[model samples]
Target: MSNQHAKPPITTTNAGAPASSDEYSLTVGPGGPNLLQDTYLNEKLAHFVRERIPDRVYHVKGGGAFGYFEVTADVSQWTKAAFLNNVGKRTPLFLRFSIVAADEGAPDTDRDVRGVAIKFYTEEGNYDIVGNNTPIFFVRDPMKFPDFIHSQLRLPDTGMRSNNMQWDFWSLTPESAHQVTYLMGDRGTPRTWRHMNGYASSTYMWVNAAGERFWVKYHFKAEQGVQNFNDAEAKAMFVEDLDYHRRDLWNAIARKDYPAWRLEMQIMPFEDAANYRFNPFDLTKVWPHKDYPLIPIGRMVLDRNPDNFFAQVTQVAFEVSNFVPGIGPSPDRMVLGRLFAYGDSARYRNGPNYAQLPINRPINEVHNYNRDGPMRFHHSGNQPVYAPNSYGGPRADPQRYGDPSWFVEAAEIMRTANVAHKDDNDFIQPGTLYREVMSPTDRDHLVSNIVGHMSQGVESFIQERAVKSYWSPVDADLGARVAKGLGLTITA
Candidate 1:
């Protein structure tokens, strides 16, 4: 065994001056009001006042830790990504778990999608895998994302969340049935951040050295094992500790009981995607594991908690567009939307120099003509900012890294509805899931849970719409059972 833990000596300000004292703030007249003339006091107070930055619009409540990703199995045949090119390769990483659609003060145990963002500091660059716990999402198209979020958020008039508005959007968007079923189930309420599984629901592209592209989906199976709270249990946990999930994660790491997850990937050949039964790139669907078996790629263990929560967790940005040379995005519409939205939101919240932050900065050397933004920290070293200049500066190197090229067949370009497949009838998968995937006890609990939440809304029509959507997906009997539990009759 090796002892890799050694603390660095404490230093003073940016000028590298040694500090005599750090404990007491400089004050006037022995506990009188602090003097404005004190440089250290002014620096500390001014920074403290502005320490808090803007909160993220989504995934506001988050927890993070330092970790390493160790490759367990070879995946070089599928992807030319250097991080996963060989077995036994370990890359430093940071993991952030967050609650989607919640305020910073919101309870961690709320019934919301959990975000799992992994920043892999690779030799190529920082590669980020941003995903949720569920394998599917509510909307397939990116254009509908804003509308969907608006519907799920607080009502414009009342400034309160409305179940009616949520159901109204879900009922109208039939494509949301698959993800909605998973969200309504017990898995929606994870016990803690450590116990939940993370998934890359969107299909991505992995190109090998030979220039062969493969569609890939990522899964992080929790080594702690999946554990969820029932509706009652989740509510109780919230009241007891609003930061239950965050606390659990912090305590686990503090005790040296590091939590881990196995990285698994489902890969499909490029040609198969075009002729596949379902649209492989759809966000609202899942690739059957039977057809595309999960291949073990790596393992990630979170070992160290952040020393400064705000610096490491709150300001840390993960963007889908932050891809290295080999790993790239697929044509998944939702992913295409996110590649733009995530980076744009980070720029808005943290400024254009968000990438310069320590937590988000890449371990590899960065050279580009990107100069002069808000809070520009780096000096380009007298090198000409413009390319093809007389002075030596970073020049475009195509041989070192070639651009990604994937085959795209002829298709009409228009803002029409999604192309429906022969198997595109929305209800079949959710129906099978309800009948086959769930056990008898699980089915009973599912019905009970649905009825409990549905009973709270005031609008009768909205309730009817909700019931109909559920019934249409599963059997009529299951729907009737929920209706009976809610003291309502189902009509033909």
Candidate 2:
């Protein structure tokens, strides 16, 4: 085992100068009046009135709460992350739930994909899981993200959203079958944020204490149990309460009816991924439970609501790039893209010192070269900022701390599709979802939802293409039923 105390005692300040007893403010001898001669006084006062930065673009309408994630089962063999090392360990966390594509004033009952983001304040650093309410996503590649969101947003000519635009994009992109199926089903309109499961939809890499790696996916099953509204009920909810989900979450916590979720992981041995039945990293697919069953590791309960909505809820940021030791990203293209997009979004919304925000700040002390932004507060007194200088400064300690990364093949860079594995067809799992997973009542609701949404102003050509090319490939009956609902004939 590597030595935890590999680095020598901190002999220099973060600014790279000799350390000193600067913990106290300069004052007149013992109990005399304080003097301005102490330059430390000025520095202390400045940090006291620390300025705040501006904040957001997406997940606009949301609610969140403070919670603690308690490890239920020991997972030390799967990950070396300190928070997951010991059973009964409780790590403070903040979870935010949101409705994607909805504006700040939009009704929470709208049928849309829900965003689930969790930030774990671990001993090492902040580990974030920025995911969605569903296990699969609409597109595998990040290149199609903006286009997909645009299709869901309001049209340019008239500031009103069009279902035709959505169906057109989904029909053109066949890879979206699985997530589209989930969306057009009863799951789309969750009864409340507390009644839906959350998934870290992208595959990730986890390293054990032995340095062995594995491919992993995260699922947070709502202990409240999954509940949702059918198409008509969801529509009626809009008229009943615009903020139904948000209100329910707040009131539940306030009344001591805490919402909880059980954390489960589907882990695949690292070497198995190369020859897996399908691309394990595909955002549009799921690794069947039969192959790698879920291992329940922890339980998260949201027992405390945020005091201020704007500061703790709206301003709270979750960067997908935030990874603690023993856990890192995978080859999933969407995950790779998000590693940059999410953090950059935070910097743009909240200034470069966004991480310094109270909600985003880690529980442990942060010592790094990151300095001098809009609302800069902390300054390493008298220490040089740069590293590798004669002046002592914090340096990388790979021997003591493992990098949250894996060995990558040095392949030639080029734009192409992800490598395909056996049984990699996009429609396979969604077809299984329709045929096997969904109950008879669930299937009826799915078909009805699809028909209800697609029948609204979709072009005849798009309707035919969706039924024949998209839904039919997923399942013949599904395609035919959707077509029958649209009063259209399926080709081929």
Candidate 3:
């Protein structure tokens, strides 16, 4: 009115074209039924019906936050990762704590492994540590992953989870014994997401500038302190409040009580791995601290909660394949499988343009020829979409960096069992853990806990197999006690 052109009233429409009317649909007459030719009405109804997307196959229930990872100690000598190049260098990060093997609406307090995934928005790219609370996994090979997950999930016919199915899979796969021991112990059910630790179960490779490589594992020790609930307590919590873990995490952050974890690593010399006591690369096993001690690396603190749960938490994707220059994958079969599975799952769930989402997008500028897909928010703009075009499209930068190489003299690529090491036997560490690591009270609770859950399954053979496995690892007396508690005869 005052020399400025008056703006028109806003009108909603499909795509971008303005619509004159949205409340009423085009009809045969003014007061009659709507017609199919009503493009606006049809578009509105169509979109509203298909708004929801496919849910995640696992780690469905989760809590997330925004935070920073600061390099508190000197770890640059291990690798040339820019995030750990300097002390006090803070990198923006988003962390999601989840329960593995649960549905989207499953109870948060269920007795299952917790997933502690961190996405570090580094200058180079978004590096993800898609890991779990246990340092060891059920299977060392990827071919067994689907079967393992199927056992944990609901039965195909009855739509109910079966303890028989779970124990049968565990008993058959001897590699699962280490993780099964931990699962049957107190640590299986964490008290809360804030009080749990995380581990990169798969061994990774860290390469230095001198082309020297070392096998490493990442451990996140909870600064809030590790706490866990027994089987009964976890069940009661589920009935009382299914969202107890989620609420606890949200309330803690709301009260300005942030959570933190001290990042540590178990480093093994390259040559030492070749002659190690056990397979350093086995996902089903852990490297003893005596052989490879924990070295302090950095600190990760979750200071802020996500503003929107759906945008930041639900849509967040973590892939094991997201590695930086100095960080690379090892020959661990489980890890190699996940590198493909995680990324493939995201693409199927969120389309090929999933990486363009704000939560998944890296802090660094993405320069690629990949163009045109569903939900492609960003356009290359004036930049050419195809490579080798004389129009000055972005080209591959070879000088940037490359992964470290090692001499491999092995012949044939056929799958085979690991060459047994001096301490390759399964029962030794689990035995040591039960006898030495646990106190008298802890052992009593561990036995009681196993008996409680094992009673749910009707298969006596499965129970016997479980008891034998537990006993073989710890002590015959402990096994006998568990058998007696389960109302079964303990065979000497």
Query: Candidate 2 clashing pairs?
Result: 15-383, 15-384, 16-383, 16-384, 17-383
Top lDDT hit = 2
* Candidate 3 error regions (>4 Å): 1-41, 381-391, 490-492
Clashes (N, CA, C under 3 Å) per candidate: 0, 5, 0
Rank list by lDDT: 2, 3, 1
| Residue lDDT tens for model 3, 143-195 | 89889988999988999999889888877777777787788788888999899
Candidate 1 lDDT tens digits, 1-492: 235697656657546766555787667778798767667656666778987777776788889999999999978888888988889999999999998877888889888889999999999899999999998888889889999888777888888887778878887888887777777788879998899999988999898888888999999999999999988899898789999999999999999999999999999998897778878888888888899999888999999999989889988999999898888988888888898899989898889999999999999888898888899898778878887888888787788677766767799888855555656656777777788897886778778877777777747787776677656556676788877887776575
467 in model 2: Cα distance from truth in Å? Answer: 0.9
The C-alpha local distance difference test score for the whole of candidate 2 amounts to: 0.88
lDDT of 2 by residue, 1-492 (tens): 348879756555445655454576566778887778655556557766854434344578899999999999988888898899999999999999998989888889888999999999999999999999999999999999989988988899999989999999999998999998999889999999999999999999898898888899999999989999988899998898999999999999999999999999999998998888888889999989989999999999999999888778866889888998889999899998888998888878777887888999998988777679788888887776887767777778887576656667999988887756977788999999999999999999999999988878998998999999999999999989898998986656
Name model 2 segments beyond 4 Å from true: 1-56
| Candidate 1 Cα deviation (angstroms), residue 482 | 2.4
Candidate 1 deviant stretches above 4 angstroms: 1-49
Task: Give candidate 1's whole-model lDDT.
Answer: 0.84
Could you report the Cα RMSD, in angstroms, for every candidate shown? Answer: 3.9, 10.8, 4.2
Candidate 1 vs candidate 2: which has greater lDDT? 2
lDDT of each: 0.84, 0.88, 0.85
Worst 10 residues of 3 by lDDT: 1-10
